[model samples]
Target: MADVTQLIHDYLRHNKKFPHVFCAGCGHGIVLGSLIRSVHALGLPKDDVVLVAGIGCSGRMAVYVDFNTVHTTHGRALTFATGIKMANPRLKVICVMGDGDAMSIGGNHLIHAARRNIGVTALILNNQIYGMTGGQCSSATPQGDISMTTPFGSLEKAFDIVDMCKAAGASYVARGTSFHAIQLDRLISSAIMHPGFSVVEVFSPCPTQYGRKNKFRNAVDMYKWLKSNTVKVETLKDPTQKPDDGRIPIGVFRDVEEPGLEERYFELQRKLMGQNR
Candidate 1:
C-alpha cells in the first residue's frame, strides 16, 4: 500500500508505454497529469481503466497511456466508451476528445451520453480550433474568432460546453485551462472520483494554428492570456456582473450526484428478474 502521492510518482515512472504527440505547451499534458493522479488517488487498477479517445491531437492520448486505451473513430470516443462501461460495469471508462471531435462530429453522441448520465468521465481538450484538421473553427470556438475556414472572422456563436453538459444531465461539470495546472488536476480527480457522468472542459492552446492567426507569439503567450483571462464563478457572483470582453470562466461550475444510467438499468433488470423469481 504505497502512499497516494508516491503511487502517482510510481505510475508516472513505470507506465512508459504511452507515446507523446502533443505540442510543446499542449494542455493535454496537464489534463493527463491530473487524470493519472486521480487514478492513483482512487487506487484504480491500470488494467481496469479503459481510456477511449477519438481521432485528433488529444485522441492520441490513448496511445500514450498504459491503460486499456482505444483510439476510436473521429468523434466516436464517447459512443465507444459508453458501450465499454455499460458492458463491463466494473471498468472505469474515461473518454478523451478534442473540442471539434466531441462537440461537432460527435455532438449527437455527447448529448446522449450526458442525457444517459453514464458512470464515466469525459475530458474535452478545447483548443478552440481543430488542431489536427488544419486549424478549422470548432463548435467551442468563440464568436469572431478566425480560423482557416473563417479567415476574416467566425460568424456563428460558440456552444457553452458546461451549460450544454449541465442541460443534458451530466452529474458533474467543470472548466479549466492549461495555466491552472493544480486546479485542473483537482477538478479532474474530483470528476473521476464522482460516481456519475463527469465532464472537465480543458481550455487548450493551438499555438501554431490559433496563435498565429490570433496574433499570439507562442504557446507561452497563450498560457499567459489564459491565466489572466480566466474568471472563477465565485468571484463573479454579482447579479449585474459579467466576464470582461476577453475573459472566460473557469472552475468547478457544477457538481451534483445523480442516478447513473448503469445503476438505473441494473435496477430495472433486477425488477424484471424478480418477477420470474
Candidate 2:
C-alpha cells in the first residue's frame, strides 16, 4: 500500500495552513482525509473542483484542501454551491457542512437543493453535537444526549440525514463513519461521480466536547460505539428486517439516474433561444 501520509499530502494546501484547527481526537480530520483520497482516486484536476464550506469545524475543510474553495456563511454553503453549479455546470461542486450547519440552520436549503436535483455533492459531517460552537445539541443529536445546551438531556428526535436526502429527491445518498475510512472514500467518490444532487452523511466523532460530556471515555470508545451501533445496508437484505438493537443503518441507501437541474435548465434555454430565432 502507498504511504497514507504522502497520499494525503498530494491534495492538501501546504503553507501556513499546514496544521488544521480540529480538536485532538476529532474525527473531522479523518473525514477530510477520506475526501482527499476520493478526489485523488477520481483523478480530477484540482482547478476543476470547487469545495464550498459553511461556518463550523467541517466548514474549515475547504481551506485546507488544494482546490477552488469558497468559505461561506453558516447554513449557506448549499445555497452558494447551488448557484455555483447552476452558473457553471461543468465544474465539480462539493459542499462541506456540519450537522447543525446542514440540517438545522441550512435545512431548508438542503431539502430544496435535493428537491431540485442539482448537480452538487453535499458532504455532511455529523458528529451529533455542535462541536465548533461548544457542545450544544444539534438537530442530529441523539435523543437523551447531554450537551451544553441540553443539560437535562436532548428531547428532540435526531434527523436521519440519509433518509431525508432520499426523500427530498437526492439522486444519490450514502452514510459512512470516520472509522470506515476506506468505505467513506468510496462513498464520497461515488457521490462526486453522480450527476444529480448527492449527499454523504459521515458520522464523525467529536471527542473533545461530545465525548467528554457524554462519558465516552475516549475517542476509541466513540469509534467502537459507532461501529457497533451502525449496521451495513447489505446485511439487512429484507426491507422489513429492522435492526432490533436500534443501530443506525449505514451504506448507500439510494443511487439512481436522474435529469439534473443544470442540464434541464440549459436545455430549456437552448430551446428558447432557437425558437426566438
Candidate 3:
C-alpha cells in the first residue's frame, strides 16, 4: 500500500486527466505499473528518465508519466529516442511501442537500432493483435489466429521478437508476459541498466480486441494461458531439465556487454579534437 502510494506520488503525473484509455482488463496498465515500479526501484532521478512512445494504444503511456516523455509518430519512436540519446547521452532513454509499432512499420528502425547498438531501452508490448486500431492482424499475432482482418485465421507467421533482436545484435534481449508482472519488473530494470540497445518484449493482453475474438472467456483465461504456455529461458539451458513441451520461453535471451553507439561516437569526436590540437 505504501509502495503504491509512493509510486503514484513519485512517478505518475498530477494532471487531472480522465481515466486511462485502455479497455477494461487490459494488461497494458499492468505493464505500465511494472515499468513504474522498475524505475522507482532503480532509484533513478525522474528528470534523467525519458519515456518515448510510438503511436498506438501504447503511445498513451507517455502522457501519464512524470518523466520526460514524447508521443512520437507511428514507427518512429526509436528514431526520436536515438536522437535524444545522442543529444544527451546522460539521459536514460526508453521507448514503449506496440507490436505493430515496433515490428511492422517500424521494423526497419528496430533493425538499425539494434545494429547500431544504441544506448536505449525498447519496451515492446505484444498483445498479438492491433488493439488500438481495429482488432486486426499484427506482426506478433499468432499464426492461424483469428482477428477482425483474419476472420478465417491468419496464415502469416508471427515475428519471433526475441530471436529477431538477438540476431540483429541487441546487447540485451528478454521476454515476459503480463501474467508474470514480478518477473517483468526485473526484466525491465535489467534492460534499462544494460549499456547497449536493449529490447524487452512484453506479452500484454488485449482483452477487448483480442480475447473476445480468440474465444477466451475473459482476461483471467488469457493470463492462465500465458502462465501455462511459457517456460523459463533458464530451463531450456539446463541439461537435466525435462522437455518444455514446446512452451514459449520467457526471460533473458541475451546479455553481452558492448560499447554503445553513443560511446563510440563521442570517442571518435575526442580523437578528431586531439588530431586538430
**Tell me, what's the RMSD of every candidate?**
2.8, 1.2, 2.0
Model 1 lDDT tens row, 1-277 = 3464464455553555444667777777777777887787677899999999999899887766678989999999998998998899889899999999999999999989999899989999999999887889888878899999999899999988888998898989999987887788788888887788999999988887788888898899999999888888667865134475657878886788887898899889999999989
Better of 1 and 2 by TM-score: 2
lDDT of 3 by residue, 21-136 (tens): 88888888889889999898899899999999999999998898899999999999999999999999999999999999999999999999999999999999999888888899
lDDT of 3: 0.91
Error of 1 at 215 (Å): 0.8
- Worst lDDT run of 10 residues, candidate 2, spans 237-246
Q: Assess candidate 2 and give its lDDT.
A: 0.92
Name the runs in model 3 displaced over 4 angstroms: 16-18, 237-244
Give the Å shift of residue 126 in candidate 3. 0.4
The TM-scores of all predictions, comma-separated, are 0.91, 0.97, 0.95
